[model samples]
Target: MDRQKRQLQILDHVDLTLKEAEFVSVVGPSGCGKSTLLNFIAGLTPVQSGAVEVFGAPPGGTEAPLGYVFQQHALLPWRNVLQNTVISLEVKGIAKAEREQRAREMLTVMGLDGFEDHFPREISGGMRQRVSLARTLVDDPRLILMDEPFGALDAQTKLLIQEMFLKYWEENRKSVLFITHDLAEAVALADRVLVMSSRPGRILAEYEVGIPRPRTLDQVRHMPRFTELHDAIWEDLRGEALKAMQGRA
Candidate 1:
């Protein structure tokens, strides 16, 4: 397919599967179709070839709920944190009181308890992203797609949110497909990390992250196994990333 006067071939011969409650992370060179893959799975982008399914059905074909947290929080600025979080439930025709209750519970879990009534403008970017996460989780989706959700935050805030995210995932065990350029982030949060080639992206390698669960980002980094996995994947990713940069230049 052509995008903006250029033929944009995003995926080629890419076959992937995510088991229930699996956490898989995809990392690749810029413009290597990481986000594109997520969009396809979420049914936001139309697929011209090959099958894309969730829960044994075409994307959005099943009754299973799906949640997405994008790089941009995409929260409605007019709505307070609570109202923003409950928007999905409201769309599903949930009752007002019940939606509010659920939203409050999720916000609390996301560390946004006292900030519920605060507008998005009133909160920090990290907090806004937390609200975004709470919004997605409120529906209790079986599958969650995150497209560089922490990419915009400062390092400290990013680390904090990452830990919080790990906690939530460990507790709920929802299937997640996380996309990021940060190799460490990918390795730390995922059960498996997939590396992709540049341009018409394809899976170049898949590395199983054998690090034990109930993991904190700090603790994971100290492990020799984590370093070994990160280095190995970086070697494979480095060439593709250079090619992508050269193409842009």
Candidate 2:
């Protein structure tokens, strides 16, 4: 199907038998339709052929809920942290007091306890992304689709947030479809990594990460297996990445 910015054609199909509480990372060269796959799962984009499912049924046909976190954070500047987190609940018709309480509790988990009243403008980039994460968790969704949620953060802050995210993921246990260009990030966080090739993207490779849980970003950096996997994937990606850059030139 045609996307506004990119197109997707899933062929020789592969399906994710995603069990509950699994974290899966998707990586690909630019224009590989990584985010488009998420949109198809979210029912924001239609599948031209083949089936797409969420919670054992077609996405839009089921009662399951999905939360999305974008690269931009997308938090409202006018709203304080707590209000921003609760806005989704409010829109879903949840009671005001209950939604506020739940939203604050969610923020605390992301280490934003005292910053509940802070507006987006008043917070640092990392903190804003935490608030964005808190907002997604507050909805108590079964599935979360993250599209480069931490891509904009500084390296130090990205490491910190990545660690914090693992903790949150371990505790809450939700199925996630995380999209990223960072190969290291994919290996560190995902139970399985799906790599896609450039434009009209298709899954080129899928690797299962057997690493144990509570793996910090720093730990993943030092693991031999991590390097092995990283290099193997990069060997495939380097060509695609170079091709993409050359096309731009």
Candidate 3:
């Protein structure tokens, strides 16, 4: 499909029968059009040819209310955490009192209870990302799209957020389309993992993660099968990652 000047072709189509409460991860080498596909779903970019259906409706035309967390926190530095979170609802014409109340409830869930009045500059990177998640979740989206939502955090923070994400997912159970380049992250978080190839991206492999849930970062690291799956996916992604790096170099 060609939108504007960009072309998107899903050479190896992977059908996603996401249930009401499942987390699905898409992992691929950087620049494999992962973000592009997410944009198509978000209606930020139109699907020129191939169909994109979310909850049985074409996304670019009549999509569900969506909550997206990008690679960056994308929080407004000027707005305090609470104010920043209410932007989306405000745009939708939701009342200030109701939205703020909902936003506060979300902030509490994300561990930012007392920090609501703090500016984005006042918080740590991980906390900023949490604020970003809070901002998105306040709207009660049917499906949340996460594009490397924790890619920029430190290793320790990444692990913390991964655990936090698991807790949140378990509680909310919203259908998720999480895109990440981190193999372990995808394996640790998703019910099914979609692996894609390089440019003119195609789904190369799809693996259903049979591991038991409430999986913490430590438990995932220690799982015997985790190493096996990681190695297998890494082997698949290595060539593409190297190719992408070389192109950039």
Q: Which candidate number would show the highest lDDT if scored against the true structure?
A: 1
- lDDT against true structure, model 3: 0.86
RMSD to truth, every model: 1.7, 2.7, 2.7
Q: Residues 1-249, candidate 1, lDDT per residue (tens digit)?
A: 655676568899999999999999999998999898988998888888899978877886657689999999999999999999999989889999999999999999998989988999999999999999999999999999999999999999999999999999999999999999999999999999999999899999999999998998889999999999999999999999999999999
lDDT of 3 at 165: 80
Q: In model 2, where do residues sit more than 4 Å from their true spots?
A: 1-14
Off by over 4 Å in 1: 1-6
Error of 1 at 213 (Å): 1.2
Deviation in angstroms for 31 in model 2? Answer: 1.6
Pick by TM-score: 1 or 2, better one: 1
* Candidate 3 lDDT tens digits, 1-249: 655865446434544566777888999988888898889888888776777788788785534878889999999899999999999899889998999999999888888899988999999999999999988998888999999999999999998888888988887789899999889999989888888888768888888887887777788888987888888888888888888789789
Return the TM-score for each candidate structure: 0.97, 0.91, 0.91
Q: C-alpha displacement of 218 in model 2, angstroms?
A: 1.9
- Error (Å) of candidate 2 at residue 229 is 0.6
lDDT of 2 by residue, 147-187 (tens): 99999999999988998888889878999999999999999
Point out the worst 10-residue segment of candidate 2 by lDDT.
Answer: 5-14
